[model samples]
Target chain A: MELYIGGISQGKLTYVCNKKNISKDSDLICDGAGCTMEELLSKPFVNHFHLFIGRLLKEGGAIVTDGAIAPDGPKTDSDRHFLLKPGHAPDPEKIANVLAKDLIAENPSVVIICNEVGCGIVPVDRTDRLYRETVGRCLCRLAEYSQVVERIVCGLGMRLK
Target chain B: MIILITGGSGSGKSEYAENLAVKLGKRDLLYIATMIPRDGESMQRVARHQKRRKSEGFHTLECHTDLKRLPVHGFPTVLLECMSNLLANEMFSEEGIIKTRGNIPVVEEILEGIAYLDRLCEHVIIVSNEVFSDNGSPYAETAGYIKLLGEINCRIAGLASCVYEVVCGIPVCQKGSGIL
Candidate 1:
């Protein structure tokens, strides 16, 4: 089954990925990075995973990881892991299609990291509002593809298995 | 009251804001001008704005990048003319240059300062140019700055009770009714 992890805290994901034996693979296709969607899709890979931290992940065909922001506290763990992502919108689907093709072709268990972009007040600017909507749609698409979904609040993880 | 007026270059936002301040009969209007006297044309623009405000007898506060240090004497209206320029000044400032990429602490500090000013003022009007309008792809740094500026502008606009989008010298208020 595909596993997705996301949250606003980078440290948490790094820790989890390390524990789960997921590190930067030369074969990994990372469309969520600043690279163009075309570049990510074109890259050859067996299993594709997208990692999103403080930002939104809009690319398709992968399980989504939830990386919501942490609430007020020291670096210590708490129950706020289910915090939502920050930001307004998602990247275009055309870009996401590139990444989706790679993940589906390989049929490997793909994990995605995405920020919950809708946890804040709605923005007044059109572009800002559009961003939030885009991110939300991206997450929805990712959830549709995933066999399981999970949310992290504070430091606790609840699996939608 | 505190208002921030921001817009892209040549959007005529500053001119509209000047007119609005006058219509409000705020003789002691605190115009927090951000543009510096860089070149002759820029100098002239600053002078013209100063002259127009002076002719109408409006008080002005000229600040470079240090909004935190500006004296806040409880002005009824404070107009933060343009945030992009302020951000540019702060980002390229001697100390600002030392901060590395993705190090958003400085920008956060500035946002916090703006939020503080907004809370302290009675009635604030903010003006900002829409930098995302029809411009082709910009350099990476420029694009990053614009995105960051847009984020800050949206946050501030969210707090504003009134928001206006000035198009072709016309003010379209997106929120709140009544003219300034």
Candidate 2:
């Protein structure tokens, strides 16, 4: 599996397409956004991991997102980590072992793209902080098993592996 | 060669800079740690960083603010751990005063610091943060902080031989390659 990561609008998808020589073929595209966990795990491309987490938060236990930003919502102590890992996202170990294992086995060249959102100050909201940590952990998990981990900046790809 | 390595938090900019310095430094290798740990979180953070660079054979000189603390000679190569903290230390007074709340003065001080480093070492590698790649305006003070970091990044990048922005632990070159 090849990991292509950067901030939003850093040309990750275009770089992947050009590098993979994948042109004019929607058949190769696997829409992973908003898919059920089973479906998303089955697909080759896992897009919108952040949104997936959001959807999971709304659907799961111990995760109550009054949403990403809440200026008027009353603050509460319920925001702190109730468990070691929030129930919002899928079990990272399972995802790494099951989905990631399957991906590496079946797909010869899988392009994993994610935006870098952990740069700024830690968010005031618990959900936002959890979201940032989740994405970061997910990326690290994926990169560990990936053959190539590339970070794109200003349309330049660096082979970090 | 002067190199600027920048990225988002947890993006491995420091690690990349260390690798490059290890690959290049043959003489007096200096690791300029700019962090001043004043709290538990910060002490833990600095400890983690120190652990990572433990076996990398670095002579860490904690120059929290003043760049002149670095030696003027003998150090062939110096890797400045980060610029963000240095800016905060220099821009803010101990009485909770903030100097150069504007961009020009902060940028000038940063550039002057860089020039000092340039003269001190034969080669310098600076690790900075990518502060402009975020959404929405932060609080006014934070927004001002980000603006200062962005300005310093631009001018120093223009002066460096190579500029790398590491995203997700990968180093992507943005300017001239330091390696021949």
Native contact recovery (fnat) for each candidate is 0.00, 0.27
Per-residue lDDT of model 2, residues B1-180, tens digit only: 689999765566777888888888965678998877875445656776788777887788887665755564677889998888887777764521254343446667668878988987778999998667566364786777778888888888889999988765556778995473
State each model's CA lDDT, in order: 0.52, 0.66
- Residue B75, candidate 1: Cα error in Å is 1.3
Docking class of 2: incorrect
Give the docking tier of candidate 1: incorrect
Query: How well does each candidate superpose onto the true structure, as a TM-score?
Result: 0.48, 0.69
Candidate 2 residues lying further than 4 Å off, grouped into runs, are A4-42, A52-111, A119-161, B38-40, B71-73, B93-104, B136-138
lDDT tens per residue, model 2, A106-161: 55365676777777755666556555645654566567778988778888897778
Question: What is model 2's native contact fraction?
Answer: 0.27
Q: What is the lDDT of residue B130 in candidate 2?
A: 66
Error of 1 at A21 (Å): 69
Model 1, B83-155: lDDT tens per residue?
A: 7667776676553432544455556766776766766665566666566643424467666666777787788
